[model samples]
Target: MLDVEVSSLGPGVIERALGCLRNGHHAETDVPYATLSSLLERAVEAQASDVHLVPGYPATFRIHGELAPVDGEALAPGDVRRMVEAILPERVRGRLETERNFDCSVAVSSGGQSHRFRANVYLAQGNWCACLRHVPTEIPTLEWLGFPDALAARLASHSNGLVIVTGVTGSGKTSTLAALVSLLRRDASLRILTIEEPIEYLHPVQGGSMVTQREVGRDVDSFADGLKYGLRQDPDVILVGEIRDRETAQMALSAAETGHLILTTLHTRDAKGALTRLVDLFPQDQQDDVRSQLALSLRSIVCQHLLPSAQPGQRRALALEVLHNNLAVQVAIRTGKIETIESAIQTGKREGMFLLDEDLQRLVSAGQVTLETARRYASDPAAIKATKPAW
Candidate 1:
């Protein structure tokens, strides 16, 4: 059922768990805990991005951009349910049994090292299933994430406005946002507040910043409600984990307009897509108002992608498209001429703006990635090919 490894989750988190699982419903008489634990250790050793446990299928690990099966027998349905229940709270366990879905994060400490994961557990075709994304303990800096230090600083320099990190799922949005927060906390004595679901990376009290983190469902009912209360909490900078709904988006925009630096994530592919998603979130009657509000408070949008690295054992390479709001960007957003914003970005490279395709081409030229790989993930394959280095 729930595959938490003993060494991984540490003594306090799972001591009573094994005993409970031993007497669990499944016919598993032997301690099945080691089965899940060994799998996790192997995943970490392989530098995997995610781990998956699905009934009727062997345990799977996602390495780089590919998923591969590990050595293991397919678990029975009852065993899957039992494994999931071991770590879930009683209320969540009941909900999972009834509703068959939930999202949560887990932390494991083993061999004197700590590891965290962001996970979503659900039912698949009447079988229990879960996918877990690994979160590293040591937070990386902007330089480590492959962003220009100057541009990163400019984005974090905003005292009051909206800054968004947009990307698809598993595109490293959480890591980049944490890096920005870590960098900001280094010297600024600002009051930073974050509302996350299961809180990915912890930002403790730094020398100059008072960092407070709250989780959704656990600490707050929802992001929208959290923002409403967060505004009244006297926070200098607020972090909304993700603005999926219109209410949360509206509250985030309002917070930005009302003199608070708001950082958040969106599942848009690029800079222009981020703009479109914001206005399209509202109904037709409110589109114009949202456009205006977004235009006024939009400080920057950083869209990123992780490309497979050519070097053996090296991590993924980050390609980003940065759009810092300027006179032209503001005009395009407010006037509903967002399609024209691309040319502005291309010509605004001197002002720290760049296209995603151009950045991919840079990686190809640097020999860090192949031209084929670059073109595969590029916004425009033709554009990327036109600038391909003669290798």
Candidate 2:
């Protein structure tokens, strides 16, 4: 069971308490606290992407996109609840009964290194269960995240417009946005502001770039409110965690048009879908205006996926469909002919546009991923074989 005193402490004190107990230092915590920390340590050591704690199962780790159960007895409902409560901060714990499903992140110290994990805890069959994904402490460079140097440079060079990184869940979209912020941080003159739900990556004020990060539940009420107030903060670059609602999409577009560089994310299968998704967030009367705003203020959309790699040691390869807002794309957006955007991407190779299928074929040709793997992820599997590998 969780220690009553530890459960009421703030997140920092809870982290320290867990660290001391995990290191075998004498503390007042109980077995559940130690068990939770130990499991996180093991998951990090094994390089697992996520950890799952559900009733009737031993602790499970997702390694290289495969779930592997640890060698142990299955946890009971009480055991899982106790372990989860050990890490929940008092602020979140107070609202658990009211908000049964929520997301939060924790930082743990293991082997003298700090590891962060984004956790989603919810009720299943009236019992508590949790899913935690490991987040790296260090921000990787854009080039390190597999963007070509030319493309990386182009992404960082944007002064004021909407730059979106779109992908499905667990496809490394957050990391890409954080890396872009890190890239912009190199310029000390820029002031960057980011609003995230549960604030995953904490940006230090390194390189003299001013970065202010705000969490949704903790710092603000919602993404729209965050953006509404964030504009008055006088920021050069603003990163909204995700554009989930119409208010957020409107505010993000407005910010981009008003000379603020807006970096955000959306959930879409491919680049063309991203364009449609944004405009569809509003009613019929507003979509035309939104499309005009997008055509004027949009910069680029990077739609990417993580394909299970065939190469030894490497776990996954990134397949990307990049759409830069060139003249044809702008015309298509302004004229409401979204279907023509794909043809524009196909012909705009000289303008640094590439289709996702082309990237998948490139990966397959380079032996980074199997042909079957590429086919599984391609939007059009027939187009997979039609494209040459050079893009």
Candidate 3:
């Protein structure tokens, strides 16, 4: 049976109280806040990517793609609700009540250092639940994120056109986008602007470029609004956190067409699917225009997948499809010959473009990853074997 705690004080206070108790210290008041803080500290210590607070279950932490329940009594629905509500601001609480779901940013301090979190609080099974994703304090570099040197170099030097990083949730899309933005920042003379929903990574203007990051709800109403204003900001580089709607997509294409380098992400399975999704986002009447714009402004598409490494207790490896815009590829896009893009990628190795299968095969041949794992994620298994080493 789950433990039930009746507390009107709220989850934040409860968390702090728990933290104090867990740390062998006592709090005079606000026991809930201490408890919540302690839970977060434990999650950080365990290197968890996300912490889940759900009704009828023990608090859970996701570490390396697996969820483990914290060793404690399960929480009742009321306790979960109170804890979640306590952390949210009044405005966010009002929005959650109206919308039944809310996305907000949370900052917590520990050991005199602050950590940021992207939180999604929603109603599940008629009970309030929350999931918190940890946001790193500093932007990660390409090498730090384990991207290939050649691929990172290409993304850094592309002066104009659109470059997209596509992946599903938790696939490190944001990390890759941050790496590219960081690379551009090193160029000193560039002006960069980014629009994100609940802004995850915060980049400091270290070298040449001046960067401005805007959050969707805080700085702007929507992704389209940011893109609309981004054009007038005189930015050399524009980073759209996600191409969510048709208006934003059109805006991104226009930015690319106007000679500004645009970087963004999408949720897609593969490189071919990424292009198809972009073109399909518009109405049939506008698709032709979208295709033309895309063909002209498309620079590169990098589709990444994170796979658990063969070695235990190690980080995941990224398999990527690096697509560069060339004449044949552009023609394929303009003519709606999306199927031909894969063959073009296969033959365009000399031109710095690589299909996902090619990258998987290289990893398998080098013994960095297994052929079985490569086949599981490959778009075409037959193509993967062609790159295998001879026994």
Best by lDDT: 2
The stretch of ten residues in a row with the least summed lDDT in candidate 2 is: 1-10
Residue 33 displacement (Å), model 2? 1.0
lDDT ranking, best first = 2, 1, 3
What do the candidate models score in CA lDDT, each in turn?
A: 0.80, 0.83, 0.79
Model 3, position 177: C-alpha lDDT score: 89
Which of 1 and 3 is the better model by TM-score? 1
List the candidate numbers ranked by TM-score, top first.
2, 1, 3
Error of 2 at 22 (Å): 20
Per-residue lDDT of candidate 1, residues 171-238 (tens digit): 99998889988988886888899999868887765597888899887889999999999999899999
Could you tell me the lDDT of residue 53 within candidate 3? 90
Report the error of model 3 at residue 129, Å: 1.6
Q: What's the TM-score of each model vs. the native?
A: 0.91, 0.91, 0.89
**Per-residue accuracy of model 2 over 133-204 as CA lDDT, tens digit each:** 998888888777788887888899999999999999989899899999998888647889999987887888
